[model samples]
Structures are given as C-alpha cells and as structure tokens.
Target: MRKSFIYALLVGIMVAWGLNVTALKILVDHFAPVTLTALRIFTAGVVVLLFLWGSGQLRKVSWNEAKQIGVAALFSVVAHHFFLSVGLTRTTAANAGLILGLVPLVTSLLAMMFLRHRLTVFRLLGIASGFCGVVFVVANGDGGLGHLSVGDVYVFLAVLAQGISFIMIKKATVEARVMTGWMLVFGSVWLFVLSLVLEPGGVSSLKDGTPSLWMIFLASAVVATALGHMFYNQAVQHLGPAESAVFINLNPLFSLLGAYWFLDETITLGQLVGFLFIVAGVVLGSGGLDDMSARFRRAKVAAGGRKVGM
Candidate 1:
C-alpha cells in the first residue's frame, strides 16, 4: 500500500511535467520569443519565491548556493529558453517535439561518457530505440534536414543545453546547499536584463496588455513553471530520476497534441509510428538490459560466495 501510494504520486507529478509542454506552446502563440520568455521566467520566479517565503525556505539559501543558482540559471533557463523560444518561432512544434525527444538520449550519453555511470544493456537499448524513433519522426515529417537555419540550430542548442543542465544540476546539488527557487530567481534576473537591452518595453507593455492573455500567462507561470517544478521535485523524491525520466516521454506527446488541437496543426501517421519507436526505445534502453545485468551480477556474487565458503 505504501509503495502503491508512492507510485501514484510519481505518476501524477510526471504527468504534470509532461503536460507543461502544452502550456509552453500556448505561451509562444501569445507573444514574441524572448519577450514571452522574459514574462514567463520572471513570473515563475516570483511565484516560486513566494512559495519559498511562505514555507520558510527562503532564508536558508547561502551565498555559495546563490552562485550555483546563477550557473544553473544561465544554462537551464536563460540559454535554454532563449534558444528554444526563438527556435519554436521557426520550427513547427511537431518537429520540435520530435527533436526534443533526443534530450534523454543526450543525457544518457553524457552520463556514460562523462559521469562514468554504468551503461547497462538496458540503458543502451532504450537510448538506441528512442533514437530510432526520433529518426522516424524526422523522416516521417515534411521538412528537409538542411540544418542551415538559425532557428533550427538554436532549437538543437536548447535541447543540448538542457542535457548539460541536467548534468550540471546533479553536480551542483551535490556540492551546494541550494534552494530550488534560487535558480528561477536568478534566471528571471538574467532574462530580465536581456529583455531590458534587447526587448525594451516588451515585458513592460505586457502589464497593460489584454486581460485574457495576461491571465493565460499567469496560469503558465503558476501552473507550468512553479507548480510543474514543485510536482516534479515530489516525483523525484518518490520515483528517482531514472524512472521519472520516462515521464518526459509524454512531454512531446502533449506538446504536439496541443499544437494539433489548439494551434490547428496536423499529426501525420508517420509521426505516430515515429513516436512508438522512440517511446519503445526509451522503455527498452531505460531498464530491460539493466535488469538482465543485475541478475547476472547477483548470480556471479552468489557463485563467488559459495567458492569462498568452501
């Protein structure tokens, strides 16, 4: 019963994380790239800070932790959003969803090559299967892979930065006493600075803008950014990153679906097949092989223990 309760929490948080993509698409539809991003991060930061203050968590952040937050802000929020928001302007959400699916594969590869983490057959197979699905999604789509456009490059950069952000966040949490809200706070500052210079009057004008659009933006800030991260942290505590990473597979699904339903885009049959392959790969690489490896190790240890006893 306890385990089942934990799993339920995990699944619920994961679903929230996956569904955030839909909110992101809606955000893009309503405003310019960086302009929209400045508002989102700034608003999200405010909400997170308020939550921290309310929970008595705000006073715990140290200067060292502040520095770590600054670093994460640079990559995770500042760079990632700047690139991704701009990229989405040019790239269709369908293709962007397919491309973003590669983030976990990139994260796994980084884990193996840099973190020296175990790359069990399960991980490798999941990565491979997911990669193939990405390929299918791309091939099944209409655009040629010219890779020349600034937007295309920026979107890829965003995904890569996200992978790097995951690695760095793991490292930072190990080294510093940090608050989760701190990163968003610093990110909001960094983005705001950029907005001041490049997008003058953009964020300011938003204050006097349409009430309905403003409400939409507020929902995104609260639900998608603050609430989403809150739930994700809960999930991480319950399920661990390995199992929870699977939930991210639903991100693109929800994003593309939003594009289809709200933005009135099409989801081709090929993209559906592509999704299947990628999802299968993620599942397979994530654990089927790890289970086999663990079983083999147990058998080996038992055999050695018997020999030692004899």
Candidate 2:
C-alpha cells in the first residue's frame, strides 16, 4: 500500500479512537464501567474474529504465540480498558484524552528499556516535557502541584499497560489481525471475570438501556474498538512502533474536539498547554522529529542532484 494511504488510515483510526473516549464516558454514565468494558470488548472481539474467518485470515497460533497473546491481552485489553473505563467515569473525557497523549512517550521509554532503543538527550527532554504535561492535566487543570485526581491516576496506569503491550506486540510474529482478535478475546474473558466480581448487578443493568444507548455501544464496539485496533495493528506491522506511535499525537486533539462536540465539555487552558507539551514530547521522544529532519535532508539532496543534472 502507498504511504499516503497508510497515513490517512492512521489519521482515521486516531479520530475514531479519540471520539471513542467520549463514547466511553457516555456508556459509563449509564452502566457499570467494568461490565460495560467486558461487553464492549467481547462484542468487538467477536466482530474481529468473524471478519478474519470470513476473509480467510484466521489461523491457529503456536503455543508460544498463544502465551505472548495471553500476556499482551492482559496488559493491553484487560488492564488498559478496565482502567480507562473506570477513569472516564470520574474524569472528563477531555482530561482522559490529554493524559493518554503520554502513550507515545511511555512507549518510547519502554522501547529504550526493553528493546535497547537509544535514549538520546532529545528523548530525555521529551520524556520530561511529557510528564509535565500529564501533571497539568492530572492536577485538575489548575496546573498546580496539588493532589492528583484518582481518575487521572487510573488513566496513567492504562498508558503504562498499553506501552508494555506495544513491546509485546512488536515481538509477536503472528499476523496483526489474528493477534488483535485473540488478544481481544483473551482480554474479554479476563474483563468478564473482573466484572463478575466488581459489578455484581452490572450485566442486568444493561437490560434497561435505551435503544440509543445500544446504538452508541454497538458503534463503539464495532467501529472504534474492533476496526480501530485492526487498522492500528496493521499500521504497527507496516510502519514499526515508533512511526505508528507518532500518529497517536493526533489522538488527543481528536479526543478534545470530540469531547467538546459530543459531551459539551469545556477545554481548559491547562489542557491546551498540556496538549502542546505532549505533542512536542511525542515528536521528540518517538523520533518523529528525527524522521522529519532526515526526510527533509533527503529531499534537499534529491533536488540538488536534479539541478546539477540539468
């Protein structure tokens, strides 16, 4: 596929994912967080599995791959979704979205530690900037060094779990779609177990859901969770982790806009500042800045060669 197409796809995925944060807030307001997450993830998993089977892309995994998928699901799907769901219940979607902008920086740091990716001076600065941004968001938009919001804390944990899962994903040899399907399936099982324990009447709560609510839930599951992850996994497979992570910077912007439009949430000045810092950090820490510079130099050299030839 062309780079342009892949870039466009990534942007679309970010938009879906960003708006899904608001969708999640809507769901949690109506249902138990863990229970809702379990249902949504399981539904999305079934959709992905059906797609794979229909497309003749479904294949059996080796024992080791299954183990990897199990671990990845634990972190990525189960933990990340659980925390994100609960977090959204307590915090504004705008805050959750901005906090999640830390994902690329966290992923880059994890890569440095586990994958032996170099921690350049720029990356260090970027990491510092990213944390500062999170602080502003987590401090309830006062930009003060005050007590942190518990919801923001959960969202940060979600980021950490997701970052670790990215490392596991990078090491997996399975097809991206197949891996994503299995991960969702496995994670859904765990989430269901958690819901059973934490939300005793949660499943029953869904019985009272309005048709509109169900519509939102289905859209979140099918479009945002299932298709979004499938496209993202494909992008990571094609582009590698760092390049794919760069696209995540767009996620917060979309989320902020979605929150404003869908939830009527106000965008605070601190959040705007946090967004700027986080985007800068993502670019620097994820090596996006370096990549841009290299591309520019290559283009410059090409243009100079053309001039000499003429």
TM-score top scorer: 2
Local accuracy of candidate 1 as per-residue lDDT tens digits, 1-310: 2657766665555445444555566666566658778778877878877876787656765677667778877888899888888787776677677667667767777777778877776677777777677666656555644334555567778878888877788877432223456677678778778878877767665565577767767777787777777667666666677766667667667667766876677888877887777777766665534655678999999999999999
Candidate 2 has its poorest 10 consecutive residues by lDDT at: 139-148
For candidate 1, give the lDDT: 0.69
- Please give the clash total of every predicted structure, in order: 5, 0
**Highest lDDT model number:** 2
The C-alpha lDDT values of all candidates are 0.69, 0.89
Clashing pairs in 1: 122-285, 122-289, 125-285, 126-285, 130-281
Give candidate 1's TM-score. Answer: 0.83
**Residue runs of model 1 more than 4 Å from their true location after superposition:** 1-6, 146-152, 174-178, 204-209, 286-310
lDDT per residue for candidate 2 within 250-282, as digits (tens), equals 999999999999899988788888899888888
How displaced is residue 233 in candidate 2, in Å? 2.4
